[model samples]
Target: MTGTFKKIRRRVWLILNILVVFWMLAGVLCMQVPPSEFWPAGFVALSLPGALVLNFLFLLYWVFRRSWLLVLPLAALLLGWNYYGRLLAINFAEEVPKEAKTLQVLSFNTHVFNAYDKIVEGVPQVSNDMVDWVATHPADVFCLQEFYSRVNSIEYNNFNRIGTRYGKYKFVSTLETDRIKANLGIVIFSKYPILQGGTIHFLNKQRESANRAAWADLDVNGDTVRIYAVHLQSMSIKSEDIENTYSAIGNEESFKKEGRNVARRLKRGFIARAQQVEQLLEHVRQSPYPAIVCGDFNDIPFSYTYQELAEELENAFVKAGNGVGATYNGPLPFLRIDNQFYSPGLRAVSFETHYEMGLSDHFPISATYVLEPKAAE
Candidate 1:
C-alpha cells in the first residue's frame, strides 16, 4: 500500500513538472507566431512570466530532492535565454552623460487628463495637478497619448498650456472630438522644428478606437529623427467589468461568466494589437531617419506585439532601466506594458518609469537617447 501511494505521488509530480516546462516553452517560442494566426499563443504569453517563476521554483525543489528533474528546468531556461536575457538590466547609469548629444523623450498616456473629473462640482478638478506637472516638467520631445483638451476652457486647455512651456512645433492627431470641443487624441510636442508629421493608419478597420499612433519628423541639431508616439489598440477593460469582479469572487458560476467576458476582450485586444504592430513595424523599417517609439503598448514583453517590435528596435528599459519594469499602476500585477524602443542608429543612455505619478492608470516613462555617429548622419 505504501509503494502504491509513492508511485501515485511520483506520477502526479512528474505530470505537473512536464506541464510547467511545456507552458514555459510555448510562451517563449509560440509568441513569435502572430496572434492573428494562432490566438492561443497570446493567452500563453500573458502567463509566461508567471510560468517562468513556477519553473524556477520547480528547479529548486528538484535540486533539494536530488532528482534528475532539475535538468528540464535548466534546459528550458537556456533555450529561452534571449527572452529571459531582456528581463534583467546590467546598466547602472541613471542619467545621461553631460557630454553626450542627447535627446530627452517623454511618453505618457494622460487618461484623458482627468478632464471629466471635478473637484468642487463647480470649479476645475484634479486635472489641474497634471496640467501643472506638464507645464513645469521639461523634455525635448513629449509624446502624449490620450491627450485631452477642452478647447474653450482656460483651466483644462492643455493644447495651449503645453505649447506655452517649450514646444512651438507640434502635431495633434484626433481620435475623437465632440460638440463641446472636448478633444481626445495622441500628440507630439517637440522643442525642435517639426519638418513633417502624420498619423499611422492601421489597415485593419476592426482595431479602430480612441487609441491611435502618431509620428513626427523633427530637425534635431541638423539631424532628422522620427518620434512615434503610440497608444496601440486598447484592451478596453471596462469599469462595469471591474465592478463585477468582486461579486464574481466566491461564486463559481459568476466567476466563470465574468472571466469569459474579460478573456474575450483580451483576445480581441491581442489580435488587434498584432495587426497594428505589424503595420507600424513596416513603417519603422522604411523610416528615412533614426526612429524612437514610445507610449503604452498595452501588452507585456512576452506578447507578440512587443516581440514584433523588439525584433526591429532596442528596448530602452532593457538597456538602461534599473529594476522591475512594470508600468501599469492599476489592479493588474507587474504589467510592463509601457515602453520605449529605438532604431539601431540610436541608443538609450538612460531610462526611467515615472511610477510616482498617480494621475493615470499607466505610469509615464522617459528615456534619453543619443544617436550613434557611425549609424546616423
Candidate 2:
C-alpha cells in the first residue's frame, strides 16, 4: 500500500508539470488571434482551465501528455498578448494633439432625471431636469444618452423654449415605445449648424432595450466634425446571482468553487462590453471627418471597453483634468463613467466633473477641445 501511494504521488507531479507547460503553450497560440476576434478567442482562452481540469482527472491515460516542444511557441504567445495591449495603449494616445479653438462638449447619462432609484423603477421624468441641465451647459456641443422628453409634443410644448434656443439640435430615440420614458434614447445639441444627424441601434439579442449610438455632422469654422454619442450595456451584477454563488457563501470549499464562477461571469461581461466597443471601432474606421465620441460607457479606464474604444481617440480628462475623474454618482466616487474622445487634430484644453450638481446620480462631464483646422483634413 505504501509503495502504490508513492507511485500515485509521483504521477500527479508529472501530470501537473505537463499541464502547466501545455497551458503556457496554449497561451502562446492564443496570442496569435487579434482583439477583434476576442469573442471566440477569449471564450476559448478563458475556458482552457476547465478543459485542462477534466484532462487532469484522466491523468492515468497516456493521451494526457503535453508536448514539451511547444514551450517556445507558448512563450511567444505570452509576449504577443503583452505587445498587443501596449500597442492599443499607444494608439489611444496617438490622436491627442499637444496644442489647437477648443470645442467644448458635455455628455451625461442624466439617469433620465429620475436618479438611481428612478432608473431601478424603469420610470423617468419627461424633460424638466434634462432641459435644466442642457440650458445651463456652456458647451459648444452637447450629447446625452438616456434623454427623455414627452412634454414637448405640440400639446404641452414644455421643452419648446429649451429646444428653440439651440441653433441645431437632435433628439433621437432607439425605442419608439411610449411605455417607458428613458428606454433607448440619445440627444445632441450644437451651437454650430448641424448639417445632418442619424441614430444607430445595436443588434439587440434580447430585443428588450436599445443599446444605441447617435451622431451629428457639425459645420465648425468651415469644417465638418462628426460627433458620436454611445451608451453601452449596464454592468450591474444581479444580487440573486451573487447569492447563488459559492464565493458569496463564505465557506472554504464552496468559496473556491463559486469564487471562480463569479469571476468568470464578470470576465464574460467585460468581453461582451469589448464586443460592443468593436461596433464603434467599425464606425470610427469608416468616418470621413474628424470625430468626437462622448457619453457614459458604463466602463472604467483600465477596462477593455475603455481601452479598445480609446485606441485611436484622446480621452479628454487624461489631458486636462486633475485627480481621479469619477462620474457615476454612487457610494464610490472613483467611477468615471462619463468620457469624451476626439481625433488627433483636437487638443483638450480643460476637463471638469460637475460634482457639485446634485440633480442626477451621474455628474455631468465637460471638456473644451481645440481643433486644428489645417490638420483636421
CA RMSD (A), model 1: 2.7
- Predicted structure with the largest TM-score when compared to the true one: 1
Question: What is the TM-score (0 to 1) of candidate 1?
Answer: 0.90
- Please give, for residues 217-236, the per-residue lDDT of candidate 1 as tens digits: 99988888999999888887
Residue 213, candidate 1: C-alpha displacement in angstroms: 1.2
- In model 2, the number of clashes is 5
Estimate the overall C-alpha local distance difference test score of candidate 2. 0.63
What's the lDDT for all of these models?
0.82, 0.63
TM-score of each: 0.90, 0.64
lDDT of model 2, residue 332? 48
